[model samples]
Target chain A: MRPSKLVPLAAATLVAALAAFPLSVARADDAGDHADARPAAHAVHDLWVTVQQLAGGDSAAQHPARPAPQAVPAGGPTVNLSDLSHPPDIDAKLHAIARLPAGAVRLTVPNGQARLGDYSIGSEQTSTGDLLVLHGNADVFGTLRGNLVAYDGDVTVHSGGVVTGDVLAIGGLVHDQGEVDGEVRTLSAATPARTAAPPLSAGALVARNAAGVVGVVLTLLALGFGLVLFGRPSLEIVSDTVSHSFARAFVTGLIGQILLLPTFGMLVVGLVLSVAGILLLPFAVAVYALLVVVGVVGGALAVAYAMGETYTRRRLARGAMGSPNGYRYLVVGLAGPVAIWLAWALFGWVPIAGDLIRGAAILVTWLIATAGFGAALLSRAGARESFAGRIIPPEALTDEYLWATPQFGVPAVRRPGKR
Target chain B: MSGSRRARGGRRGGRRGAVALLLLLPAAATLHAQTMMDASASRQLHGESRLDARIDYAAGTLRVAPADAATLYRLQLRYDRDRYLPLARYSAADGRVALGVETTGGPGLRVSSREHLAQEATVALSSRVDLALDITLGATEGELELGGLRLRSLSLRNGASRTSIRFSRPNGARCSRASFSTGAAELEVTGLGNSRCAEVALDGGVGRVTLDFSGDAAGDTRARLDMTLGELVLRVPRGMGLRLTSDRLLASLETAGLTRRGGAFVSPGYERAMHHLDVSLSSTLGGVSVEWIR
Candidate 1:
């Protein structure tokens, strides 16, 4: 590869690696002493001190550009910038600064003897307010009473310069030669750290996806539990219906779904046409919704229960456990369906496989829900003895033989014995 | 009884039946020959400044957007000609335009699945003129984008369809009232604040309904929502004050960042807020979820 192409490739690889394994890199760096650590710590400490001075109202003045007497101890406030830079206070201050008006001049370093360009702050200036240099360089040769901010630029303080406040360089370098007081900070121009938008770490992504999956699983489990608790018998009937006539129930459910909207519309129109029907519209709608929910929930429960029963019986045949009850069946049924859904959610992190799995899960769930709903409807919401009543023949109406009854044919012949 | 007289009566009846069958054959053939076709219609604004328009469509993908500067309204339709055709009429006298694409044949006409019609209508209004709109749809997917329009009043009704109505831009004039009614349809309306309406009403049945109040409104507004059988989701802007009154039966409600007062959910600092939304919700058998967004 050409040198030019290799550079870009290397950069890309580095970025990808950082994004893929940010925690590993951080841990490795922390395990060993790094040259950049000391400087970073020093800068943080200085910035904290500046924030404290400004927050304490020690540097408040009407004319921010006016020079003030330095209040420095023998070693210049022995404040560890680290100790003063509290995360909460820093966040609050940043938020306050962000809320300031766009055109408001928060700080200014005076144009002194040396005429510096628009992008540079002069050296002889004594700025009492927060000095902001936009896409420029701040060459501080004099005293800076307030915080110095160089955005997308460089800040250089000569040996003769003295800054009582914090020094911040965003996307630039901070060459501190003589900073008597306050914290000093520098952010690399290559990174957009000042924007506070870092690529999402892989760990975070995995954690988020995992949390989402867990939440969905818990919700489904709760729903299943509720179904079993409130409508156990109905759920079992629906399950039996599905087990006995899966294909029939599925086809009926599909048809019912297709016709649901149209039927509802017709009913609504009818109600609107009739004066008395209008009054019952709300009640009718409520009943319709209740029926739909029952059908869907009942159908799903039935599928789960059937799966559970089969598994349980298989285990029993293998001499695994005691006789199974409704609760056991419910657990088995819910577990199978929920497991499928959980797999779908967990594998969603994978590109193609996740989508395929999700699609399959949705298709299966819809089929089961629809079929269950149809089965429930067929059973008259579990009021009927069986959902397969249409296919099953009714039992004989009478136990006595018709021919035998007639054999007593002439009532007189039968009565002879009685007489 | 007379055999000859009975035979004569039967012959006469047979003749009448044959005549009736012969009469229907031609009509049936004509109906059967009606196939799907693409058609379009457009009208330019001549001297009219204001418009009161009504659009009635059934069983098709309906799309509505702003028209070009020169045209007032343009309609593009792809439908089974035998089943339906587009009809448009404009009256300059009262500044009223009625547009409808309706079924031509009687009910139960066999329309192949592939022959489902698609209708798109684009309408332009004079910035200087006020407007009133009424729309009705049936068993169709409908999208209406009404923005940067000087609307006076609006009403929409739909049946067994999925619809989305949006206003990306604020209204040029304040609307007195706006209403929407649907049956067994999934409906979403975004940027209600842009409607600049004093009063809004929504009536829904069977399917999901979403009302997004996420935009800068000129003043406070009131909305009344009535639903049955399905869920209702309300997206409210964080800064906008909200007060809600609900009448529910066998339905669950999930409210975020709201305090209950006198049987109503009210946002924090409701009394002092500059802009407020007062909502009255009535539902049966469905759930309601309210989300506050910035």
Candidate 2:
């Protein structure tokens, strides 16, 4: 390739890659942002804890003999230090304690002690049981026979310091320069664990399901009416194709479904190999998806029209008195699937029976949709009417031919006695 | 007159039905919900001389590093509670531990996306103990820093991930072998010399790979790399004796500083260099390029 060709090719390749980059890496970017936010949150939490501790200390000094009250939280005011295994539970406990009103707050640590501010253990000192340190770093210069937990603070195990149990620092880091006979952990800024939403009641579930079904039916009805108003001729052709060549339409739809992925793969590979056509890859993909959606949806609606037309003509043949039009045919055809779906929507809360009904509804809908899709393909999206049973042979085209087709509700004429 | 009134009544009913449908659409959309939670678990070192650690993470970001001398193993996780369960099972009898996340009957074959970020895990293993580590990743971005740890043997199975295994410092113990099997991933192994392994093997499937051999080498190393597709970039120290034998059918080799010697490629001072490296590569469709690192 010449330089002139190469430059544009390079530019196109760059543009294509840039355009495709977000689809592949958008999630990664969001993940990175979340990771970055965590550290910032930790810093903010530390600052808040520091200010609160300072304010609390001054207030404690003012009331020399006053005993601080316990702060009530979901995990209760007391944090049991016996088991330091589940960190989130401990975090929840401490998170509540940390949010206590700024003044001195008392925490009950069973079999251990709680410190309000920065705390330290001397080289000669030995503390037993689990120790809870709040709003400050815990410097361990001596042996701690129990677990050490620092909430909104750091924990440092210096040389010669020995911790017999686990050391955990919430919203902080663990700087271990000494031996810990147990595990060490550092948890990032605390966020409450979100549990799955409560299951809906049977009545509520039915209501939701019914609403979903109604929304879908109404949307389809609206689309069907538009098709009737704007594209009745093509729609009728496709609908007639479905009624006349249901079997052929169904087989074609099945083959189309099976070939969808392979066909897409081939198209992509062909475009990519063509090099210059790579610039049109994204547009090609979008167009392919749009075509598939149109085929399936439009075909399904056409099937409904065929169904409604069949039903209405039969009723009219029986001398039923009612005005007939494309709109009524669409409405009548749509009612078939809607009725099945409504059955599911109303009784879907009935466990086994509901699931069975839903499955059947899906199967029937797919059956009709496949037939519709096949009809659309056979009729060339209503552009060709070969399979629509509307073709009249040149020799058979007489004044009686129009009357012979009673689908339009015109009464059929009798043949001559001589014939 | 009655017929006309019936038509008006039907129109009014149609208008009411449209309004009802508009109200139903919003209620239909409130059915989706997800939950994320955090959990941590660890085990203390108790005179254990060796350990077999297995990590199985399905998705998200993973980090594995050497823990403090006092702890045997530790894992911190933030995961989708509805989709996965935190795994931290330890068998004291066999000196083995399983750490990471496991599926809780959730959808299988989850691809990397924004939801993956919510499931993260950090695993730390003791540097004091001899370790045989096995890791499996799916749709993950991982960093496994194995340096400064006593590694006996290593095996990693990567699935559709971007991962880097780095030996930032010299291994504390001699490793028998390190094997990696990748599936459609971008994998990089840096400071291969520091890994202190007698043999390194990589089986790659359709992804780019970079192998950097730069550090203090104790002895001659043997590396076997097999790539089905994608590029492989090799970085070796300038003063190393490098001999490469390749079985490539549709792959290109770029040996800028190496001479072809009887169907094999060899560095200038292959016979007398301080450190020796022998590489046998098999590639079907891709390109392999060698770079000399100082």
Candidate 3:
């Protein structure tokens, strides 16, 4: 291979290797996150009672014929030991038990036994069901016919120790020197239970949706006021175009939306192929996206203006007392779409009715936005008036013609042929 | 430069930096938005012998290594609990274990970004038992180290994933075969000679693949490679004899150090070498490159 090509190839290989290395060993922080969360501490009592019994020591003499596993004291907690899965639930239960006083820390393991402090079972001894050990390590040298769960302690299955079921050590590790027929799980820290909150009530849902609708309307109103303040002429032209050529604008907007992605992709590919244009690729993409957003949003606002103006004009014609102004027109125009959304928000939690209203609102909003976008395109972002029905005849501008024409309201029809 | 020109340049640079930061802020928010759950599970080795292990991972980074002889299998997983649940099930009756992550619902279309599904799982398998291992991956980056394991057979299937399988040390048992099937994935297998497999098969569709046979070998082996598109690179041990037979359509081969013998390429001293690697390759619209390594 050529040296020049080799340099780039080697660099590429290095980059790839560097990128893969992190993905392979990037969980250092995760370990810290889990390790820092310590489970609640359980009071320690009757420590290593099982070990003493196993050795036939003083504690064993007190229980001559294997006395029934009793609580350390009265009114203690009881834990179910049938299933060892779902660590978070078990952690919560254990934490609740841990909070009890030392004398009241007795535990009831359903279908099994619960022991506090260090526990053990010697070889030749066989136990049944599950065993829960808290605040101490579990040393097993015998046969356990069921699961073994150790909380805040280690589990050592010594030689000849046989467990017929799963073993779990929470907040500790498992030292396996013996045989286990089931799964062994060691949790360094008991993760908190999943916080998937319950569903909200219908009233709460309605209130939330209403808040969202109000926020959206407020934002749109601010944008419309700014447009009226700075570029009323452009807004007026676009509004007029939407009123005069609504269907044409809608068709153009639909086509533009369909071709948006393909056009962007083509622009990108063309730039890459033309190496010099690659430098301008990012700027070009940003500009293109900005233009699209401006057209769509500005057009929607223009449509609202047109709607408000028409309504105000009709009200004025019917002798309703109201100021005819750009701000008033925008406000009136925006109220139409906002009212649809308001209806949706109010009834959106009504099952089928809510969904139907929401769908109608979305459809109406999309129609208006699309027509507005098309009008913006046809009027060249309000720079052109060809689609706004603003063209005038040259004869109308003549001096004699201007003198005869009415300056306000409707142009008085030429007075029958007097002109 | 004039003072005004310098000032304008500095302002432009500052504006660009602000824009870049603004663009990156959302990406940072997205990375921190998802919650990852960490869980680990293992099983102690018992008197039982043979085992069958299956791993199915939908997305993320996966690492598999040989575990201590005392452990049957151990899995440490960090996953997105919202979409997936960790799996650790073992059946002592058939000596079959299934370990990995399963979707919360059934396998639906995954529309999230790779970062959102950034789950990680590390699996360690026992080396004492005769093992049949199978792995299936989707949109994953996997590093499987299968050396020092008593592996009997191996099968890997991946979709749009990058997976590298390495046999750093020789297998404890003779492997019957190793097979790989990929869909638009970049897969690399290193130290294949250490696998001690009699037969190796690879089926690829539209992705770059590298198979490196640069480890100590015990006996002769055969490989059948079929690729539809993209590139394939083969790294051969210098001491091992190589025989390559290819069926190609619009694909190019660079047999730099091998002799073209009739319809196939043969390494030097192929007939006298201690072990031979017989390869039959079929490819379309892809290039195959060969590199001899020590």
Best by DockQ: 3
- What are the per-residue Cα lDDT tens digits for candidate 2 across A90-111? 7877887677653546667777
Model 1 bad stretches (over 4 Å):
A1-419, B1-34, B108-114, B117-128
- Provide the TM-score of the second chain in candidate 3: 0.86
Higher-ranked by DockQ: 2 or 3: 3
For residues A21-111, what per-residue lDDT tens digits would candidate 1 score against the true structure? 4443344244322213323333343344334333343222222432221111122112122222221222233334323333332322232
Clashing pairs in 3: A78-A108
Candidate structures ordered by DockQ, highest first? 3, 2, 1
Which portions of model 3 miss their true places by more than 4 Å? A1-110, A115-126, A133-143, A151-162, A170-172, A177-179, A187-419, B1-35, B106-117
Question: Model 3 over residues A189-262: C-alpha lDDT tens digits?
Answer: 32543566898998899899999999999999999999999999999999999998989999988988888899
TM-score of chain A by itself in each prediction: 0.45, 0.55, 0.54
Candidate no. 1 TM-score: 0.43
True contacts kept of each: 0.00, 0.16, 0.51
Q: Between 1 and 3, whose TM-score is larger? A: 3
Report, for all candidates in order, the number of backbone clashes: 8, 0, 1
TM-score of chain B of each: 0.84, 0.90, 0.86
